[model samples]
Target chain A: MKTRKKVKQITADGFKYAFLTIMLVFAAFPLIQVVINSFKTDADVKTMPIGLPEKWVFNNYRDAWEIGGYARAYFNSFLVGGCTIVIVLTVVGLGAYALSKLHFKMRGFFTAYFFVAISLPGFLYIVPDYFFMNKIGILDTRMSLVIVYTAMQIPFNMLLLRTFLGGIPRELEEAAKIDGCNELNSLLKITVPIAKPIFLTVALLVFVNVWNEYLWSNTFIITDELKTVATRFVKFTGEYSSNMARIYTASVISILPVVLLYFIFSNKFIEGMTSGSVKG
Target chain B: MNNNLGQTALFAIMRNKKVINNMKKTSIIPYLFILPAFIIHFCIVTLPSLSTLAMSLFEWNGIGNATFIGFGNFTEIFTEDNVVKIAIINNLKWLAIFITVPIIMGFIVAIIVSRIIKGQMFFRVVYFIPYVISAAVAGKIFTAYMNPYYGINVFLDKIGLTSLGDTLWLGNPKIALYSVAFVDNWHWWGFVMVLFLGALQQVDPVLYEAARVDGANRIRELLHVSIPGIKPTIAFVLIMTVMWSFLTFDYVYVMTNGGPANSTEILATWIYKNAFAKYRAGYANALCVLQSGICLVFYFVQRYISKKGGMEDED
Candidate 1:
């Protein structure tokens, strides 16, 4: 009986491994195929989809880079994304800190205000937001993108930071106060440093959100040069008749930074996100 | 002696005044820190969004004089628009898929990743890399890969499954929607996997240890230990995925642009086309209002279920 059971368990384990292998293949196949196709020339791209290129063509990368003007687009994305993160983090962090730490008169109302904002779908604001931005004479600039993104991101950012800050014991701040630090000093010196992990997570989340942003960028930004990398997809490949190899290569390059960042900071990224998720 | 005593009293009073000042200074700092965020939120999200609500009441081309058309757009959304009905059904499809596929797959993949004695990090990273790519980029890659003539279709044909190749995946209105969904699942599962993996860690190792001691096998252990351990995470994921599905515009817009005769239209993309593309801003805002209502329903449903579940667990 024991021997028979052992055989059954072994067979089951083998089946389990096989199932896992198939699933992983299913999950990863398209991405791997795309990465491989990025190296193919035009003829090879069309002729050989599943297989490797006949000749390894690096010129696709060069053409994709120059023709797409990805360098400038990347810089524009960086400027907008970076400024958005800075502005959002500072604002949300402070707001969250105030909500969590302070005993202000309107604390309950303010916190509830943010929670309500967090629940609304962003697209509901698209049309009116566009009109508002246009009215303000900032419609085609990178600043418009930054301001818009920062606003949309603030409620969630505030809530996440608030949760993280709430986890920190108030004793740390009390100790800082005893040492000659004022409230501002304590927040800057004590709270910020200790919450470094959460800070990094928020910053990275902000970076990815803004970097991958499309709807707002596509809506508010009309100028060709002002388009961020995300909007470039709609502009460059809008009609869906662009050259296959070049478009694929451009798409791959444009998403490279975000992929690289995920590889680097995924641990904190996962943790911070899960914290908010689990609690919710 | 009298003069020296007077100097000490004045010094003490000044020191007390400085302490009070410092206390006042500290109290204002958090607000100062939060002011920028509030200002931006008010300017960007709150103000524009309120105006959107107001605009839904008026009929005006973006370039024209505003005319009040109270509830006219809203009335049209529910009464005459067939596209709204199609979008609502498609939105249902998205909600169903988003709720099921990610949770089920994420659960299974999380289990596999957790059971891996080696390459856990590698598998995790590999699976998650796709989620970071902009939806546009992913859509382009899929567009090529799914091309009928020269892409996966040809490969399928060479392997004797020619029918799979020749089918116009995106060209057919019937299957184009599912094709878009396939692309979305590819991009989204990794993020779900990561979330599940984190929840998996929170599952105590001792439960598995106990199952093993009882001579339970891998499947039994997973069924008995893993599923129950991450139930909360599963519930949370279900709710979030539903919300995300309803709000999905990026993948659909980028991949199909509601193409092949609007077969792949979801609420967001439909709203975009109606508002901006067709120049029906009022009608689109009405659609937007309807979408928000849909989101609210799901939000409340999740909240109710979770609350009920929490009560049952307590008993």
Candidate 2:
């Protein structure tokens, strides 16, 4: 009986390792391949797509940067992403404070409001908002995206931020209240400091989202200069369709910033992504 | 004594007015705090969505006058739109794929990773790497990687899978959507696994030990112990999967763009085409209403089921 059990254990371990190995390669192999192909010349890429380059020709990235207009893309991405994070954090911070701490009529109603907001699909407003933005004459501008992105994220961010704010003991804020601080003052002085971690989490998640978001921005932002990496990428591939290497290089360029951030903040990314999947 | 009584009544009236003024001042503070977010959210998300009902009742090219044609757009979509039928079917396919494949994969991986005592984080972090890549980047990479002449086909041919290797991945009408979904699932399931792992850890090991003592095999442990333990999470995952299945746009849009004769066109992308490309905002709104109705109904039904099954508490 012991021998049979031991045999079963060994087989399970073997299966576990085998499955994990397959997944590891399956998840990461294409990413590694893209990076590998980014360095190869066009001929080399087609001939040996997933293998090492015969010579590490670094010009593809340089060419892609110029051809893809990556400098403008990067600047636009940061501008949009930074503004979105600031706006969402500030607006949702105050709103979450009210929901979590302040006494108000329709408190239950407001809670239910955001709860429903969480379930509403982007398809609901996405196209309509384009016409709305067009009517307002902000259609091609980066500001349009900033506002739309902020609105879309507000409910989910509100949900997470309110949960965090609620978890902070009421005593902490009451201490500020006893200090003769006004409500706004108490929020800024006491709650913001204690809730810094959650704010950071929200910011990180928002940054990634704005950086990665394609559909709305693709429709709204018409100008080349205003397009972010996510939007520029489709155009880049089309324009540079003849040169596979440059497109491959552009793809890597698009991915690296997020990958670098993930490498630095993997734990936080995981935490934010899993916890902030309320919207998803 | 009459003068004293008059003065006391005046004092009480003055105090009452002061109290009312003070109450008004403090009560507006919470609304003031929330007003900015509320205005932005309402104008951008809620207002547009609400007006969609009215929009669906009208016939309008986006920038023109909308004439009221009650139920015209709705009738047209149901009776006239072939692409929508395809989109609805694709969205259902997406729902079916998501609920089964990723949930099972995530659950199985989480169980195995939990069992492994060493190097668990390494396995998790690696699996999650693909998820961080944007849909555009993934689509671009996968397109080249799945290229029949030079990509993974080359690798597969060497491994003796000639038939599978030679097929057009995103070009074929039949398999295009599924191919796009495969990339999405790659980017998706790891995050699902992490959620499942989080849920699994919250399940106590004592139950597993008891199951083992009762002479349960590994399959029995999975079915009896683990599945029951993670029932709430499973329900949550299912609900999200069904909702998101309808929401899927990025992958198909990036990869195939509902191409090879609109084989991969889901509702969201079709809505985009109608509103933006066709200039038929009213028709798009109708589609939006249809998509929301499906998701909303499913969400309620799933919640109802979960409640009946005692899988989750009512919020």
TM-score of each: 0.89, 0.92
**Deviation of model 1 at A87, angstroms:** 1.1
Cα lDDT for residue B212, candidate 1: 93
Tens-digit lDDT track for model 1 on B1-315?
Answer: 999999999987876676566547666665676677777787777776777787888886665677899999888888887777888899899888878887688888888778766677877777776677777777767877777777788788888987787899888999999888988888788778888887788889999899999999988987788777877767767777767777888878887888878788888998898777887776777777788778778877887887776612431
Candidate 2 lDDT, B65-145, residue by residue in tens: 999999999899989889999999999999989988887898889999988877888988888887777887788778777
Query: How well docked is model 1, in DockQ terms?
Result: 0.50
lDDT of each prediction vs. the true structure?
0.78, 0.86
| Per-model root-mean-square deviation over C-alphas | 5.8, 6.3
iRMS of each prediction in angstroms?
A: 2.7, 1.6
Q: Residue by residue across A1-280, what tens digits does model 1's lDDT show?
A: 9999999977866766677677678767777777778788877878768878888888878887887777888989999988987887777777887887766556787788887777667777888777666777888889988877888888877888898899898768866876977777888898899888787888888888888888888887888788898787556765434477787777778888887887788786666555544211
Top candidate (TM-score):
2
- What is the Å distance of residue A55 in model 2 from its true position? 2.3
